[model samples]
Target: MSEAVQIASIKDDGAIPVYVARPAAAPKGAIIVIPEIFGVNPGIRQKCDKWAANGYLAVAPDIFWRFAAGVELDPDIEAQLNQAFGYFQQYDPADGVYDIESTIRWIRQDAGAIKVGCAGYCLGGRLAYMAAARTDVDASVGYYGVMIDTMLDEAHRIANPLMLHIACEDQFVSAQAQAAVHAGLDGHPRVTLYDYPGMPHGFAAEMGDRRHAAEAELADARTEAFLAEHLA
Candidate 1:
């Protein structure tokens, strides 16, 4: 099992809280785990632990720290979405990207880190794509990223390997939107896209009713393989 520790983020104003998981043995590399609309909740923390188990030092920065540090809203769609949306309305994606960039810089300074990659869910998935386009991480993976079809112009900027898992039946990311994304990124050398036939948004979340076991398992396996190839 990996141990979770609180780490300080590199920032101009003040330190932000980042949860890091280190493997029992030396790390093969490092990975940044971006959370969903909810902050660094149990699920996101578990992802950090999972990556650590997979041999990478994993870090999950509290991106919601700007609005409300350690804000972890409920996973219930009806109970939490309004609040999550409120936070989303207040949050800027660019700022989140900057925070991730800072986390990347932190990863670079780590003695155990020889290569760095990132993976994200929901809103984070979109940020993972942005990280691929903007940051210097070795690889990135995104799951059901929101509004990514609108940012197809940035596809060419991605030089590092990037994987995107799109939910075919996702209401948030409709079939048409997925097609647009495929149209723009289909032939990109560094971009790989995976489509889950009947899955909906948040398909990989343990707390959600939309979770699909088979698809999540397959996507995760692919993600690990992709990481192995690129972060090697």
Candidate 2:
């Protein structure tokens, strides 16, 4: 259902490698799967597959290809986690969002997709929020997105449906940040926010210690329903 593919990068003459998944039946729409700090690893690929199984064309781009390609880090490994954080420190979300914007354009023009949405995790979650405001993505969803509070000024640019899943006890995000997020966009007519009371930062991860089974399931179910409703 999924395979490695390439998308043309308008900024350059090269092709960007991407993991693409297609549904068994005709796709209802396309969902771009934005990866966490770990890049396009197995977990991220699985996310694309999950979306494909749900009747969407799922595409995951390598946002770190500007500096590194084929990155697959494990959070449980001390060294890898540190390396991931290092990459995070070096990554500029503005550049990453540009890649996301190109991906959306490719999905629409090259892939023949009628509707395109985005679902992002961790750092990707922040990009999802940006996409809601900056791109033509039909709908956007973010899970425990870090640093979103700092970009609240751009909330007025969000013209489509946007959703966010917040882990109430996320170690990476502070109480003040969460409150700011709520205060800034809680009343936005096109936005919906969900809070998971006892979840941690990566509670919805596909595997490992960060995965909180029940909470992840609940959030994913909500995401699927939201995507189906909006993209359809």
**Which number leads on lDDT?**
2
Q: Supply the TM-score for candidate 1.
A: 0.94
Error of 1 at 84 (Å): 0.9
Per-prediction TM-score? 0.94, 0.97
In candidate 1, the residue pairs with backbone N, CA or C atoms under 3 Å apart (3 or more residues apart, or in different chains) clash, namely none
lDDT of 1 by residue, 1-232 (tens): 5444444545575666788888888888888999999888888888888888878889898888877998887667676878888888888898888888888887777644579889999999999999999988899999999999999999989999999999998988877889999999999999999998888888898566767888888999999999988889
Best by TM-score: 2
Off by over 4 Å in 2: none
| Model 1, backbone clash pairs (residues 3+ apart or across chains), number | 0
Write down the worst ten-residue block by lDDT for model 1: 1-10
